[model samples]
Target: MGLNGFSFYNFPTAIELEYHQPLDKFEKEINEENILYGDKGRAYLKIFFDF
Candidate 1:
């Protein structure tokens, strides 16, 4: 899942927001038990300027 939005009318520079979810799964076995790890989701922001 992912989402993205942008705004350019309220600020001097254009702004962008982004969200992402890979929804991935990982497992490991050490003693017959399942272990999950690693990153599950992430987000970021961006700004654009014209000079």
Candidate 2:
């Protein structure tokens, strides 16, 4: 099996986030610590598939 003349075209979009200075440190630590952390915050993304 092989990828024959195949290519990936992704159009992923997300909400551009703005963070407060002090909270940026916490965000970094949370990301480093655990994936389950940062339950209080929210993020956004959208994707579409085409053929």
Candidate 3:
């Protein structure tokens, strides 16, 4: 999470990472899914990646 060129902080895990641009009209926007990585069918990978 950062504004400008300054970094705020890194996510504790790679799978937990997300990048969302800020906008006033985005309050109702749904987060797009990454099914290959976020779906439960491949949940084993979470352990493999130490999530």
Candidate 4:
């Protein structure tokens, strides 16, 4: 399940692995570059709406 009752139909192991390791490293690099260049950090969107 995701945020606010949103759920995934099927989650594969690869998705989990990417989140834990490679994606984390990638985010760190991006953040460091932004900081060094005096740029703002990246922002993501998460919507939570139920009908």
Candidate 5:
């Protein structure tokens, strides 16, 4: 495969979520551990791909 053979594919929208604080009890429980990146809320990432 060469660079010329490649073409521009669909640039799917990248949705970025920001956690300001725990919105509900479930978020609070999960964020209590501090194992995640957030202190007041849980941090996460979403990837769109199906295999």
Candidate 6:
């Protein structure tokens, strides 16, 4: 699953937020553990300046 959002106003700046994760099952226990143990999901924030 994944999601994204952006905002733009009168200001000369823009903001973005995103999140993503695996939605499918793994074939092996090690694979599943490797994917789910540490960084199972990821998120990001970005800003843009327009001039």
What are the TM-scores, per candidate, against the unseen true structure?
0.47, 0.18, 0.16, 0.19, 0.26, 0.46
Q: Which model, 2 or 3, shows the larger TM-score?
A: 2
Candidate 4 lDDT tens digits, 1-51 = 222334445532122111111223222356457323323344334543332
Off by over 4 Å in 6: 1-11, 25-39
* Model 1 regions more than 4 Å off: 1-12, 27-39
lDDT (Cα, tens digit) per residue for candidate 1, span 1-50: 33445555756565566777766777889799988765576687877765
Which prediction has more favorable TM-score, 1 or 5? 1
Question: Which pairs clash inside model 4?
Answer: none
Colliding residue pairs in candidate 5: none
Ranking by lDDT: 1, 6, 5, 2, 4, 3
lDDT of each: 0.66, 0.37, 0.30, 0.32, 0.40, 0.60
**lDDT for residue 4 in candidate 5, whole number 0-100:** 17
- Candidate 2 versus the native: TM-score? 0.18
Inter-residue clash pairs, candidate 3: none
Tell me how candidate 1 scores on lDDT: 0.66
The candidate scoring highest on lDDT is: 1
* Candidate 3 per-residue lDDT over residues 5-39, each given as its tens digit: 22335533333323444343212324774333222
Clashes of each: 0, 0, 0, 0, 0, 0
Superior by TM-score: candidate 3 or candidate 5: 5
Superposition TM-score, candidate 1 onto the true structure: 0.47
Q: After superposition on all CA atoms, how large is the RMSD of candidate 2?
A: 13.4
TM-score of 6: 0.46
> Distance (Å) between predicted and true CA of 2, model 5?
36
